[model samples]
Target: MSRVDLKVVLLGNAMVGKTSLMERYVHDSFNCNRPYQNTIGTVFAAKRVQVNDVTLIMGIWDTAGSEKYDAMTRTYYRGAKAAIVCYDITKSSTFQRAKHWVRELRSIEENCKVYLCATKKDLCDEGFVSDDPDIQNVVERYASGTQTKLFVTSSKTGENVVELFDEIIQDFISNPENLQKVEEAIVLSKKTGERYCCAI
Candidate 1:
């Protein structure tokens, strides 16, 4: 089987469940009671998936969301093929921060496929908080404008995590032109001496 590699980044504000979503999707496991530690710079994980006739190795970079690490985290965005911009459904500020992340990603990697993720759906379902229409509209507008998809996910319940990645892989596989763009970006970044944040 021929193997293709794609780089993906997770960007959002602190404590917005970026790591949780990543862990759930990559490992098919969730730890609700696990002690939370802010990601220092970036965490790397890889999973191989089959998309149509292609075997894709998704190289995922779980970036630190703290402003203190913004300089460091921004470096990982270069040449990324896709990005998942996550926000806590219960926190309005996180959603705002997610928008900023989306803008930053677009500025840095314009061709990168972006996915706006409203995370912690289980908490939203439990009455901790309800979705705000204004925020929903903002995300919807961004998704529509960017020509991408929006997902409401719950790491605790494993909702939409797998489906999100599945759609991403399928989208890439089906779009040969975009896949070529991703490959070209990787080659150009390498030629320009850009650091590779995640291994393929």
Candidate 2:
């Protein structure tokens, strides 16, 4: 089987469920009773996914959301293939923070693909995410303007969790050039003995 490596980073405000989302996606488990704990600088988890003949090994990095770590968080963005900017659906402030992250990621990593993720979807029983005027405006006017796709996910219920990651993997594999670029980078890294992960 052919192997493809992808580095993905999660960026968002504190308590927006970045850790929970990562756990649910990587481990397929959710700790509902777990106390809130801050991610110190960055934490990583790898999950291998099979799409057709290619094996996708995604190195997902979860960064601390506190403002104090803003400087350090940007360091994790280097060489990232994709970024998931997360926001809590129930909190407008978190969405605003998500926007900032999107902009920052775009500004820094111009080649990186961005996905806007709305977390805690299970908490919102009102209607679809589009029903929220503020979120809809941001999704359409702001997120769409950046060519970002939005996913409404609930880590608690496992809703849209697998679909979200599947879509990401598909996007990477759908393009022949994307896979070529990854292969070329791996070759170059090996030749130069360069370290891509945890070098910061």
**Per-residue error (Å), model 1, residue 40:** 0.7
Sequence-dependent TM-score of model 2: 0.83
Model 2 lDDT, full chain set? 0.81
How accurate locally is residue 159 in candidate 2, as Cα lDDT from 0 to 100? 92
Residue ranges of candidate 1 with Cα displaced over 4 Å: 1-4, 130-134, 177-200
The CA lDDT at 164 in model 1 is 94
> Residues 62-168, candidate 1, lDDT per residue (tens digit)?
99999999999989988888899998887778978887888888787887889989999898688775556477677678779877689999999999998998877
Q: How many residue pairs clash in all the candidates, one count each?
A: 0, 0
TM-score of each: 0.83, 0.83
For model 1, the local distance difference test gives 0.81
Cα RMSD (Å) per model? Answer: 5.4, 5.0
lDDT of 2 by residue, 19-56 (tens): 99988988889999999888989998887766675545
